[model samples]
Target: MTETHEIGMVYLAASDLELADAADDVRGLPVVTQLGHRLGEVEDLIIDPVERRARLLSVVSGGILGLGVTERLVPVEAITRVDDRVHVDRPEPAGDGDGRHRGDPADLAEEGYQPELVDRPPFAEVYERYGVMPFWTAGYVVPYFLRR
Candidate 1:
């Protein structure tokens, strides 16, 4: 549960990854479990420039007509593979009893930051002011999705 504020990138311009250097285009790709279950579509990637690797992926979960869509942060470490789709081991059931989804801020750090994820009230206040919850508080575990 460590937390760091390293700058990252969110590629929302395309539905696929289009790096010139052979990097996998994960945008719009469906994230699935090893057992073959649709989780959700990758909306964006959080890249750590210093580490020269992707730190996290922004996955878009349930929503209707572009409304009530929740964004979840998936640590790169959790991703087991990225072939035709991003593969990840199943996550444990979320049971904090807070009635909200949450992730660890520590996972957001690229490296060198692994203390503990601290709650920043300022961020919470900002989210409250904007009528939006922080990504971490939204949900930590990825939810299942049915492919169309």
Candidate 2:
């Protein structure tokens, strides 16, 4: 039996996660410059309808903060899991490619998600009204989104 989704809820699993912080050292990662740079933060992890698994919605990041904070809407299928770390499958930069990105990051359902749900800001007004962030605690997993 499937669980019913809440009126305004986006769901993801616990296993599919990679946490990076400002203090962490990005040794092998490339620099912030370059157009086709595949680095972005893990802004969101929504369920993938096709793979039925937790996926990385956002990755390292587009650019510096306070401008747009552009996020990559990667599908769950591309996420790779190993011991103590989660990895995202970013496409290699192709020479002489068009200006467009490798894939459509908008491959998520808009129904249950609002920008206020995640820490990635720009919904300051709306999130402020709530007075609480969506997932605050360490084990903030929603059971409805999990399939065992």
Runs with alpha carbons beyond 4 Å of true place in candidate 1: 1-21, 92-148
TM per candidate? 0.50, 0.32
lDDT of 1 by residue, 5-96 (tens): 43333332321333332364477888886688776778665543443344455666675544454455555545667777888665522432
How far does residue 85 in candidate 2 sit from its true spot (Å)? 4.7
The sequence of per-residue lDDT tens digits that candidate 2 reaches over residues 3-117 is 2132222334322323222212122233221233445455444433343444224333443333334443333333333222334343532331111132223423334433433
lDDT of 1 at 105: 44
Model 2's alpha-carbon lDDT is 0.33
lDDT of each: 0.47, 0.33
| Error at 142, model 2, angstroms | 20
* TM-score of model number 2: 0.32
- Provide the lDDT at 86 for model 1: 86
